[model samples]
Target: MRHWIWVVAAFVAITPFTVNAAGAEPVGSAGALISGKSPDGLGTWTVRYQHFDGNSPVAAVINDRIDDAANHEVQHATWNGSTRRPWTFDATGTINVRPTTVSEIFVGQYNTDEPNMPMQSLGSVVCDSRSGTVITWDNLFQDKTSGLTRLSAEVEARLAPAASSNELRDWRRSGQFAPIDVNFKHWVATPQGIELHFPPLQFGRGLKIVTVPWASMSDQITPEFVAITE
Candidate 1:
């Protein structure tokens, strides 16, 4: 539940494109719609995307719409370029909308960037339709003290195999392993557990996703989130 302020100027122009995927149906003026019965057979969900432009003509435009029929909730994600410089934008990844005992969640990943700059990883965006909650990295822990310590230890153990000996030594020497420092923000929920995402340079040459089972860190997670994982 974050609030965003968008200011669109007159110079900007928007062109709509229709998406026709194999199993997708087109919703009324919305870009595309994809729906299915939940795995448990208790509910239904839909995902839609609308094409829109930013304030500037060169800006990137992409939006996501998620509907949780069982929970009667709707969530939206919108992204556009900020700078006037030449840019490249792509939202090509899987959009997973699934239901748990008490909630429906949506997760997505994409890439975007401008010239000469490193590719930006729109790592993962997750929405909980039941509570209308948007889970960010900061919300994962109960308290910064014990919660972060355990998280850092777990993450270090998982990433150690991929790091060079020198890199590992440097990380240990710094004695700081907070999620923010390591860029541990992108994440998604799976049937088995919650998966943490780390982009290139954060760990190794390419993207990395590490799954920490719900039972392993049950103590650190908030009460509300436990149901979704179950």
Candidate 2:
């Protein structure tokens, strides 16, 4: 499952929005910010990624924003080695990259169906061109490095300006969390890249909002971008 050639874009749905970054607050009632699942509930997933280098390792195209309607129908997964069995949304999701050591490049929706099969390593990021929006994750497996290190140090101690009113009830009681060893291990990188804040996966009863739009990469050798399940 490694077919490459993706260039489909059109995702605009991010309501109940908030993000000013000063002393933020008020992110409730979007069904409580993004809803729970990590106290061993499994599947309520959330992951963010970014990677790119100078001379050009070829990685460009990043647009993450899709608010509501469970991220408005989208289920894409491509992690060749293991875990790729969740297709039933129909929008678009692709990650047919080729050069691994564990650094940015992960498509969401975790239940596993078998694609390349190789998950259990959640840490590694490195970008070139004077790193800016810093990213760095390392061998995170101890419950996603202690629950994203207590959720990135308590959501960066309330990043204010907007977006945080009990932060959607603290993501429906603990940030739609998940990372009690969902079986992911091994990965590396550090040119600069790492930012994972996952939480949104239920499939029934409420929300499964999986935003994260557009991402591109090419080493040449494509044909494996599955995320069209409607």
Candidate 3:
């Protein structure tokens, strides 16, 4: 099973509204949940991490919200706090998806402790899958409240279309996998949050996805904070 994480980077102030979609059912797959609705027929979601840091994992639950696209404002999010055990992270923030103009998604959380801190460059990683085609760059995680600067990381995903069809069968039969690398670029505040990028890699199959571990910091925003944004 593959772990799917959304990347949220937009923040806008507005009244919260509930997203209600008629005749919709809760989605079960990452692909479906990303493109599906809540079981309650709303546009919001409630996801729980069953086994975050464990060797074995359980299922994650997703609820619905009143509205679908509210910049940086998540409707609902939580962690069971038990399933994931000693380590756990969860959130309920805004989610945005614009397939036509941009196949991009963003989620936002407020860091109140500190703000206007200096930025720093962390590091990067390479994807093991050869069929994936996605890359992620994270930089705004300082403190949920203070918003200081401490650590940051980037992930680059490159995909091969042909690998999508056979990825399931291939990974299941062979434990060994292809490799993809992520590298740190720089930190700069702009309309698009902290700006950073990594060089692309050529893979033979599936799309690659990556994120910085924010929940790991005293105050930071991980890919879970942006899970619905990708």
Estimate TM-scores for all models.
0.56, 0.25, 0.17
Candidate 2 lDDT, 122-227, residue by residue in tens: 2222222122222222322223366444543433333322435665456446534333332112122322212232322211132222221112111111222111
Backbone clashes in model 1, listed as residue pairs: none
For 4-80, candidate 1 gives per-residue lDDT tens digits of 23321211222334556874522212343443332223322333333212232211211322222211211122223
Taken over the whole model, the C-alpha lDDT of each candidate is 0.45, 0.27, 0.25
lDDT of 3 by residue, 57-89 (tens): 111111111123221123222111112212212
Model 2 segments more than 4 A misplaced: 1-147, 154-161, 172-191, 197-230
- The weakest ten consecutive residues by lDDT in model 3 span 48-57
How does candidate 3 score on lDDT? Answer: 0.25
Give the range of the ten consecutive residues with the poorest summed lDDT in model 1.
Answer: 69-78
lDDT of 1: 0.45
Clashes of 2: 40
Q: Rank the candidates by lDDT, best first.
A: 1, 2, 3
